[model samples]
Target: MILICKPGSPVDSAKKEIRLVEIEPSSEFDAEICSRFCFVSLDHDPLPRYTALSYAWETALTTEQIKVNGAALAVTPNLGRALRYLRKSDTTVAYWIDAVSINQDDGEEKLQQIRLMANIYRCAQTVCIWLGEPSESSPLGMSLIGGRAIEGEPHELLCGQALTTEYAVECAQALKEILSRPWWSRLWAAQEFALGSASVFMCGRQWFDSTQLIKDGTLNMIVSILSIRGVPAESLMLLKYVGSISLTQTTAIKRLWDLMPSQKPSGRAEIFCEILDQCTTKLCSDDRDRVFGLLGLSPESLALSIDATYDNSMTEVFESLTINLLRHLDSLLVLFTAGVGHPGDVEYRSGVRVRLEDPYLPSWVRDLRRPRLEWMFPPWYGKYRTPFNAFASKEWTYRYANNQLMLKGLRIGNIPAVGLGTVCQSHFYRPGEQADGRRVLQSWMALCDVAGRERGRDPYPHGGFKADAFCRTLYGDFKTTIIMSGRGDFNSVRLQASDVDAIVQSADWAEKLAQYSDEEGEQEAFSIPPFIIGRRLFVTDTGYFGNGGAWIEPNDQIFIIMGCHYSVILRPTNSLQSCTTYRLVEICYVHGIMDGELFDGVPFTGKSEDESTEAYLERTEQLGDHVIEPVCLC
Candidate 1:
């Protein structure tokens, strides 16, 4: 039906006004849901009190009707249920629900409302999260989250209390069911939860305080149950099973919790990038919402220029975002998210390849709409540890022309030989079925051997043993481990030669390989490095061993661009012009030049302590026979 605008106080676009729904009191919960719209100016003093709703717009085709201002309005069954449950018996309630407050059919109004979303949620007296009607296990889930004391021994409890095996299993299963619900996976829910001043989670008649979940250690308790030591083998296995199913949701919740006003970063750019990285796995119906949904959580300085209109094409939206990132951030770390290639370029399993529904977007732009199989660098390297600086301290100079990204860099060498790329079968296969990974590693080793023999040298061009370089390149020169200090905690340290030798020469290599996959819960002491899951090994003409994207071929050229953390592979396009036009293959990890070795006139180690900055630059320009010029990528 139609939502009537106020007689004289229609939405004042200039005053940052919004509409809120007033749900009339009803004694019967099942009675016809009646609501009316009222306008409120956020800029006005003594702001109106209302609760904002955060929920998943269910994808079911079926819908239910509700009366708004005496006119029928269509709504999803999920929303209808939420409205019915939220209705009070005697007192009327106010809500700033997106489905009813904003007219979805009006693009301009939608854009305006989106721009005010942050304030809307931030100003709300409370934010109520609807997790759908309760199931049989919901009471147990709500009880655990509500911090109800569990009956357990001191030793069996997560920190000190002793938990019976049966009780732990019950709690794990209950938490799994709750976390697996659709609400946790929606991208918009994160912004709503993070921006709300106060939030309460409701499931049918059960409710829990979000603050209590943290202050009482209920969330941490659930996490510890999944990973705590000394638990029975059967109970541990069941917990691992639960973790395997709900790891993504748990991670999302933890990330959102960290973004709450208390812990969120102060810088605009930091908040924007953090949200983008953390919410990569979240889902939204419209691809544009990949950026729009998170805008409300970002600082105004970073999001002010990013328009939230639906008229722009997906390619345009992503291109604008990439340009904005380049203009704001100092490093080219954003390029790492560009991903491997378009769909069908790299197969993730035996018969499955990564899918990109919109393949027409520019190559340099990250397609956040699809699931990325692998990133150029591991999370531990970029997040917990200092990233590589392949180009030293050179400042980047770039410009966009004809839809191509042009930047200045030095071409290092061309890939002369390539090994079989690893296919990511971790999600498709279970433990003890990782033969494909072992076979691919064996193939890479053989390729390295052939290259060494052809060069007829015991030492690589970087003055290190060929075997050492190969080993280092396999794991991206770093080792990652899940530290037990907290949930999902990762720590990375540079790999030592002895550690590599011990792993390669171990008698249980095959068993360890079988146990290794990219899955989160299955990581072990000797697990395979997750960084190389969907990458290939390549040897350059200069005898540099590298781990590159799965799309690398024999003739792809390597370049170290200014401000980029790692070397990048570029493939020449079929342009006959004198100036070369190329496509960005992927960011790569080369053993010798990762620490500015190429830029400092050194082969293996970085610039000597005695050399001055000017001396280093002068020597680098002449020693390596390198030339700095503009490189174009379309």
Candidate 2:
């Protein structure tokens, strides 16, 4: 029998002993291997449903809103289906499978395919990330990975370096040769992240070596693909392997954040909140100009946005005021739903307990019988709340903790994410419509605590509320939760270690920061100065938003206040009257600039205020080019 392989080979003499068969795309071939002692048997058929289902999703997904697109991605977890959907929309979509399709009949074919895999994907327009499972049930969460792997590579800028991109060495000789050069290696692939079972790394052309910049032809090839491809080979493919980074990488990530352009905003209004969600941390206000200056806004510019009559130090006056107004709207609606015929019952609150079973929890969370415990539950709590005494007694007025034990009940999960409140006393009772003069002042502060020189304070509305929770001074922000264990008033509250730790540590930058001191006698360039909280500065601004409205413009200027942003209907609260416009009260500090200039940027507006809220949001989203992220390659 004669055996044949595909074109391109080097065998001048040619070996007569081995025979090969070249197989076509659709025909059946022999599976038995006679030359060897074993003859493998095969029995299987094509999975048409898998392929057919995939085709439909890929075909119709582009114009349709992804959130509304079939729940197949959420329920089925089949990447092939998503690919099929994309295929329908983009006909140029070509399926890239090296193993079975290319006839892996021998080692030659295998090597050729391996060599071409990188190029094939690199050349494609869109790349689909197959992170989730094909079945409804898969380890998407566990598989979710972030950050590039850290390495001890000799870094030029920071002492240590973190990997954020990737390089391919085995496939192309030119690629391998380039990576072999110490200077070339450090120039491009020095800090990179490697992802996927195949260890592929997607990269871009533009690379800045801390201070110097250079371009590589090889790297340019990868960058060209990112810029030119109408879409990537894989539109939304998630790799199995996660990249990591070193201490240097961590610092670089923070600095690189400002340099990295924001993604073009999609239809989702909430997308804008993520930038500040983590908050503009990592540095003090002084350094804001030097590092974050690239962005449109500077600290002084942002501070200038102060509505003359509004508090100047309001951390985020616009967002603060907007969210407060929305909260008032929610409160009014709540009172109306309660059928309380009066204007005295309308008011919203900060940190409300999320209901799990009021048909509010998503099918996945409820079906899995798991709350997001990581956000709220401490590790010591374990699978059950046996160690938590808060739920031990039944008559505790705030006995709602015990009610969380039931599966269907609205139970806070062990995982606690940001934005979710840690406060608990307001769980059972509904607040009255009228302000009970029971509002808490809030502010975010940054501090530096040396052995004997550390202090604390709060920063809020015009920085004068002198609030008890957040203490602001020249130092950083710090917090303390004053809880009433037994029946008592605010003065009667006792602070617990766990409770107090939560507050102090909530805004604590201790772990992420180091102490620094600067003076004229101090040597050349020095680190940032440390802040010590002097006294609790509080803002009496009644319009600070809690967590309602947040918007980020591609221009980099952003707004974040809390309350219903996307939903037009306001939530119900204790309300006494029906007014066309609502008002909110809060304490905060607003400071930031647009593009390093000392001017407060105005929110984009249209015909009506409601229309302006969305118009400004739309304008912000329209700023950036929807560039695709590079895949990780090894």
Candidate 3:
């Protein structure tokens, strides 16, 4: 049996009126045989205790016509399944399922309900998150979560060694299937799960404690376990685990956000950018919800200013979001996540060539309507992992109106050399692909050689002109060895050193590099594999080495905006008037001068003792005074 309520009273009324549906459970197994009745409210009544159903509302669900209060009502098969599972056999169970409890046809009522969603979820006794039907992996995954302990205490499951028995493989497979569910990608589900006081995730008849799944150190445990099993660090499966764990990690992240002390309002963009980072991969039926669904979790002032108005188009809503974010936040950090234009256009290597889905969008604005496989640097990876001040200089002034951005910044120099335009000639980053790895490695070496000659010095800062130095220059630090529990025999073993010697001496380096597997022999000072995916290496005309987008081309100028921590690449556009305009390219990381401290100390100098030094000195002297100009990015 099930009870459904439809609100009939004004949202602000002191007295509330709701229409209830009293459903009678049937002995028949068929959904068509169930009997239900709609009970219209004749008087205001106190709301009854009910459970909330937070689900994906899958767009592809087959509509099943069922009798709701003796009338034919069409409901998605997924929703129908949930209703049938949650209904009680004898007593009527009250539920606040979004599809049925709210009047979908009424715009006013919908807006009112949406505004009250946070309170509703918080007040509910429990939130049952349905993840469709269970697979072979569900029960196994639940068991592993509850009972698996191969080496250390149960709590340290993934951190320590795992017996390489058949059981270990089963656990891996179970984890993979459990995380592949569609429920993880829904944008609305993020806040719904976060707001619920007591939440249990349901997949068919099996339910797992959400708290246990996201227990502290879960991600580190998973990474440790996978590494022990010799899973390649760059493997797609490992990346999937990272993505899945990120979904669970949001619980703690959101809690911290909720606990932050409220002070004078700075701007919602800071909070909004963090939320966007967490929910970037989440799916939404309407593109606008990509930004709107996060409003409640933002500051009260932000939420109040941006009403729950479904009347606006997606582009309009996005434009409004951009304008408000810029007005309140003094930084352009939000644009950091822009991908290669449209999803399909991602194959292009140059940032300037990255096609925009909307021609009207300002060059600085990125569209978040679709999800892409290429992962951007995590926000925490940036300085303090918080939004750094984008206003780089006191002289920096920006004006935004008419959907245009006008700002002042210094143009440092033009790029004389650029690294491989694309990673393995593909949009997606899969270093595991054998052929792709060869191409990427070759392309990387070629660029290093070119930039090395252009700068009149070795590309590597250490180990002058050696292959190891080139390896460091190319992969950052893949040469260092690590210690971990052995998978085959020894209780403790070391991962091998991946330095230039190991990579070049062996024929399997291509495949080996992909796995990044190692055994401890000798450890050299090598930093962790640089998180340099989607990065392009470049040398300026003055021979200052830096990194920009792979899409960067020869002659593209690097600009240091007043407040930006990283330099932005810009391309000069054809201007009919005397005023010059530049298109916003991707932000860049220069090797030793990201902090701008290196700018004032000394002019760029070449390390070579050859005649190239004279040429480098002459080129350095050719550098002129910094030029400041007003520019428009649209």
Top candidate by TM-score: 1
Summarize candidate 3's per-residue lDDT along 497-551 as a digit string, tens digits: 4444455555543444444322243222111133445555565665455545556
| The 10-residue segment with the lowest total lDDT in model 3 | 521-530
Candidate RMSDs in order: 7.2, 25.6, 10.3
lDDT of each: 0.65, 0.21, 0.54
lDDT of 2 at 40: 11
TM-score of each: 0.77, 0.20, 0.68
Error of 3 at 110 (Å): 2.7
Candidate 2 TM-score to native: 0.20
| Local accuracy of candidate 1 as per-residue lDDT tens digits, 1-634 | 2234542234667988888888877668774798888888888788878889998898889988998877777889999989998885367777899988888777778888898888899899999988889998888776665554355321234454556655666666676677677887788887788778788888896887676543223454555665553345565455445443334443444455455445333233444554576676777888899888877765554467786788898888888787767765444655666634433333356675544334576668877765444454544544313457888876555677677787766788898755334543332333454555566665666666623333323577777676667766765543544222112455434455565455455554434333433334454333356666566777777767777765666778888877676788888775586457777777888888778876664343333578653333333233366666567777
Question: Model 3 misses residue 332 by how many Å?
Answer: 2.1
Off by over 4 Å in 3: 1-49, 65-72, 89-93, 134-137, 145-173, 214-271, 307-311, 339-344, 347-360, 370-397, 416-529, 577-579, 591-593, 596-624
